[model samples]
Target: MSKRVLLPEDPRWMPFCKRYAGNIERFAIEVVGITPSYQQMELFGSVSPSRSRTSVASGHGTGKTAGIAVIVLWHQLCYPMSVTLLTANDMDQLKATVWKEIGISHERIRRGRHGWIAEHLEILADASCRIKGFEAIWFTESKTANEKTANKMAGRHGEWLLVIADEASTLPDAVLTTLSGALTEQHNRMLLTSQFTRNAGFFYRTQNELSIENGGEWNNLRFSSFDSPFVSDSSLKELWDQYDDDERNVRLLGISPQDSSKHMMNRKVAEAMYRRGRIIKDNENYGWLVLVDIASGEGLRDKSACILARVIGYGDMGPDARRVEMVKVPLLTNKIRSNTFAGYVSDNGAELSNVTYVIDSGGLGINVCQDLEDMNKVVHRVNWGNPCFKNINKDRYLNLRAQAMHQAARAAKDGRLSILTGDYRNQMLDQSARIPKTFTDKGRIRVPPKGATEWDGMGSPDLWDAVCFAFLEDVSYIVSGEIGMGGLVNSAADTALKRTEEMFSDV
Candidate 1:
């Protein structure tokens, strides 16, 4: 058997050398696959690259981590004696995953004296690269670490440094601020990667602000799993097929999906009923309503919004009532403006008489209720206290809402929920599944991924707000002897009243 002896110029040596090129070259060859396309090469080679920052927005399995690894090696080798920092949302993650990959790649490169890789054609003698966990790097709790690290990294005068942030979306704004600060007083490069989301976090804001100015300091690169040469076409198709509409949009399409848990009414159910012309009832009194959730002011961490609706109500249905419907005005920001919100309430059925406005007085909803009261509208502040008590039988309310959502999901699965087949309902359904369940300290439920706090997406707690208000209205009428109860009245009324009150209470 003849063994193939590889020479310096041989393609076999190419991978080793390419894997260790300076930050830009390594990314082009190892990660991106083709030599930096003309634009990429020139962009990186420029003395002062207009965009010192670049974001590779790609789908899962697109070798994002691998691409990042190559960039780290490149930075270390390209600028001898320079410092490059690699960090993520969590430090353990940096060491466990990213650093492990870098270590393996670095080891493969034939070592030369003074920390240089001869086979990879890169040198890292005087340069020191450190992988710091985001917690230690950002100082989320203690300012001491963050300030010290920021000052040390930033004060490195006459040194070239590059900072690479992985999973940029998950990092808090404070950490990002610290990282950004490290670039001050020196020539530095920034590379960020994440799936796109609607919240204007530091990453989103930086990308947008820099892009708009055309300031030549930032570049936004977006890619889907299909764009990856490493991902097989067949596998990509299978992934798309397996993911539900929401997951497909968020994970593969780079669009942010709404969080599912926050929704009270399922889009699927709404669509199904709408298709059968059952959305709005005939010869029934319909009215406009408003639903609100208060803000916690954790900044991008968590904010809230309410859902206002122009609902066409169906008066009491018979025991065997088969037909019931309501026309729902969709939730929109512009429509929720103070003037618009007040106008909707004051314009009572367009007759200018006092209209019924239901407001959530839980958390931040208290402020909204006050706003409505000041406006002189007959605002019914529905109090939904914290649904966190151990004895509260929280599952009842959760189950009811879950059942409503599940009914919708099943309807969608059964091809029953295609009513008003446009983008709105579809988008809503897509966002809902992304909402992950979070168990709070007080045993209350919330959504993980934290992004659900924003009302920008369809997953805003708006639907839940609307449903709670509706529940309150029903309970109020029933308690006031205005409505008669049916066979399921005991279970429904008890569950509804308990959950509604618990959810709206200030505590």
Candidate 2:
């Protein structure tokens, strides 16, 4: 096959090529032969003289790869002797995702009636393509970026240059710096496509620096999975159920996670738990555990809380088998004595017959635990200030409270626990989501003590602490030493121990 350089004098395809040169949407439809989504249409239109830079924060299954391929082909076909360069965080992504899509689109164009345009475009062995006679000057090249190979993106000066950075969020700063330097020419264009996962990065900064609304240089856009023609409702629902809100925003909404690096749990997990809590019917098969967090005094800033959780698979075969279904009806009051609080717990437990009470026995909690004990209730007086249980990861936690909070977070993440819903659900969820996660000097994960945490305008995290107390009790039954991972509450070992104790008492 002879290399044919397309000239203005070439009457066969020159007229068709010149017609769609400025119109990418028409070029994509007529030349490329594919229908573009509304978001993709906007992406094609964003390529103008005024906007040399375009950054798209795209969610999953939104046809971002196709959009990139179209722009590459459009640039190659429309402009004579033009260059398009594509790069990603790594070589595998460059070849596997972006270049793979380019190949698919190229094949599609060839199969269509517009086989002439495809004929001049020759895909090379090195993951690149070139126009038949203009092979040296007109071509698109892909490179995997790292500290060493990042410089390959630099010095790309031409009349029409398009540099695309795929998966831009995680791409190294060195690659961005080098590629950005190439956009010095007037006709040169830069395209960044990613989920924009992190708060601080070159991609994140470009979004701010190139804001069109604020009268910046770049045209920025977001493509959500909800708006994508490629994604199904069932798939979206699965994503909603599996990920927390911050992660959901990144993966489904094409929105960057706000404070995702700091928080313990996001609202999506809390809301999902609440939704599941509504559907799953409660039964009498499981024993209940009453988690109590007592306040110092009955004041505006001080309030005690009690959460009754139905323990499923408590004495189950393994830790993973256990689940905690929290009853939406929680007892919260700013005005209640320790004795009165104990009575309230006793009444709630009386119907269940087999119940265990876990009271936070720091400060005024001791008095409440004693009152519950005096009422002949099975009680575990847990001091939040005490060291975490031996079986729990002591190296990871600063204290029992930190251990409990981390455990509750893990349970929420693993779908092992249900969150509260109703009147106080907002405040409770807020507190749970705002639980401070920090690392100690020993590089172990730790949650700050209640006193050290900032509660903003809200009072003590009593409701959240009460929930943590529930998970704390899940492991508190290890007094006999080294029990297997038979989950919280009604394990076979626990039932056997209780029967033995009762038999000894009867004797």
Candidate 3:
């Protein structure tokens, strides 16, 4: 067998050897308690050229951020005067997370005194390198770092520029469009890093499009927490055990998790509930009933929702039983006019007399309640205080709504709560399951997705709110001993038919 001799200073092998030596050294020594496997090193060395658009998705703490930091530092170090843009959904996040990592890497290189680099939120490289400068833009941190701001930064003069998007899921389509437009003028590259989420928005859509476009042009890189050398098998298993199948698929396996809000409840649970039995008719033994209304303005984005619940049965199986058997009714509005809303409530109430109406006395509903009172209807206005203003009370609309929502979530998760189980209910529950959680500026939680405005607007959550209120009100009546068991069977069927007729009746 012939033996191959290695030379200490072979210039023929210098370029290839040096190209990967830095990454290998860093990985072996500085990465702490972890060593890069051959596969990891291969991926680390295969950085895309300046003009390519690439995306990297991985489970949490799998070295995605570290890899990205290395990429930014390497590009800046190797390609002189290269101007790269490091960006995220917001400025604070970009600086605090991504830029902080880059800064740490720069200090490790000990090249600060060379005068070749200027560092801050934006970095400028001197004329020694072919690239011009590097700008750090955050989309969500600063209101100013919006689509227009991203476009302006991207439009800067450079032979080649790099745009890095961290936490790419939170980025808006506008920013993506702006960045894409800005890259058109030069040999630019885009890199996005985020964990995979379900088939809802930009990340999923972009991944799909990239997979389809030109037979998948953009390079896709993926890693998982389980794949991390630093993570022990036991640790990974513990993490895996912490999440449900859906969460594990998205957060650990790097597969997009299914959206939970598309359906109001779990499909299996709803199906099981459906198989139990049909709702029986209403009996006269049931006690007093109540209808509660919560209204938003008349805009297509905000409307009103009404919930009807009653007391039935006796003792533990009495009124509470009926509460458990509460049914939801969907109210129609011609134009959100007060009289129209009043007419809607009266029509619903007439079908089931002796029902105590708890109408919202806020926004448009305030006027509607007044109209109902003027008509001598037995409606009591509920002053469900305004959701606006600072330091709002804890029991206000949003918080109360949140509390009720949590209750429903628990019930659904526990397989103990079942709604109408009809096709409409099933559809609503499915939609609810798919709805993504969004945080409002006021620190309230909301789920807003496309095409969710018609079901009382406010996204698809309006229907959910109605269901929650119905459940709460019904439970309240039952706990208050307003009805008994016999009332439950009879009232359930009566309420179901009444709601059905009201929904199908010609106005």
Candidate 4:
């Protein structure tokens, strides 16, 4: 500072203040090797005393992180006692990409001049000279950010505060406003940058609303694939050719899909089926189809599901109930092994050996199927990826998995699927929503591998798979009695039982 008595305002530091301090683009270009594109420069220039809100919704490989890392170092080095808070979407992404760039910039700073304060997750700061041997406040914050962590970014105050939020599309509106509160201090700045994947969040609002409204207090920058020279021509071409236009627009050009219908079923239809499912007949005459969904990984990593359903033919039910045609009732759902499954069924009310079991003989299911077969619980062993059965026409569906899901979706669409009211209804709906469909090169309907795509905490639809398993038309029910939670385990043998009256009488 010019007025500081302890610190000297040297000529060497004066030039940096005059030019680079006012311009983050210059500071990034000269100090660190991070070259900013024209779009990046616009975003950097937006942060000032009057106009403080700055956001960039960008595509992949646009050097968004590199641009952000520049301003983080620029704010720390230029202003004494200034605070910089950095965060990203996830822990792995923060460590591997965003923070890694900041680390790079920290290493590039002239070692002698900038007194570094590195403590928080991955933070770097330039400390001012101590006043009367007391340490001057050098503020910097970092976190592997999430919905919870983003909300905790309060109580930080400084002469100048800089908050860099990377991968901010998934960020809730509260985070953006909460982080913006830190910028109330004079000369404070907030840079929000992301690859725009989601269209209905704080990111979407800034790109749409703030960009149009008497737009003086905001800076909105949009970057696409063509804007970045760092990405090669061949790479762009390959990506364009490989992915469909909608996917390429989101992945490469940073555009959110406006039309979500092609990817998923109608929410109202699914919600209706969840709320009101018309049943033809409610008795055990419907027959049973037991589905064994074997999980692979150990501990909480692997998720196993078993769905017991009762199926009734379309013609068997009354007129109103017949609208659903084939009524499938999910009687019991559990995660249990094949060997003990008979006991589990008996405890639930169905005789295990008599019930028809349809084992999913894919992946870890092969061994599970073998274990069940050795116990003689096998009715049908189905490979999920195989072609559709004769009962369900194979032409429209890509595979058995696709066929089952589509049939379930159609039932959901028509509000025809009868699901009994239970605690698992909302969870089932969420898992169903997570199912994203895409078309193969041969025009076949395809769903991406589980855990690859996630939205709103919907990861790996194990429960939805249980529901889908019951949709197989050819699956039969061999049990004579109805399945319900109607029995308790009685482990004692008749020969081992002693009369309690005789023992009490002797006493």
The C-alpha TM-scores of every prediction are: 0.45, 0.57, 0.53, 0.53
Off by over 4 Å in 4: 1-11, 48-51, 111-136, 144-152, 212-216, 261-367, 370-507
Candidate 4 whole-model C-alpha lDDT, 0 to 1: 0.58
Candidate number achieving the greatest lDDT relative to the actual structure:
2
Q: Candidate 3 at residue 385, lDDT?
A: 29
Model 1, clash count?
A: 27
All candidates: CA RMSD (Å): 16.4, 13.5, 13.1, 17.8
C-alpha RMSD of candidate 2: 13.5
Candidate 1 TM-score, true structure as reference = 0.45
**Residue-level lDDT tens digits of model 1 in 29-136:** 543344443333443443224126676554566666655655666554444344566655456555655666565556544342222232333323222233222212
Clashes of each: 27, 3, 48, 1
lDDT by residue for model 2 over 1-507, one digit each (tens)?
975456433565677766877888988887778999998998888874423788888777899888898889888887778898888756665677777888888988898887767877888768899987777898999877666877766867788899888878777788887888767777888898888556657777777865777687667888899999899999888667644455467777887767654567778777777766532232224556788888877478778888776655531214434567677445777787776777887777665535788888887888788988888888988777777656424654667776677667767877777854475887777788777665332223466655674334446788888887766634432122212212433445666787799989967
Cα lDDT of model 4 by residue, 40-101, tens digit: 77766775333377777676677777777677767766666666777665556566666577
Q: How accurate is candidate 2 locally (lDDT)?
A: 0.72
Ranking by TM-score: 2, 3, 4, 1
Q: Pick the candidate with the highest TM-score.
A: 2
Worst 10 residues of 1 by lDDT: 135-144
Query: For candidate 3, which ten residues in a row score worst on lDDT?
Result: 133-142
Error of 3 at 268 (Å): 7.5
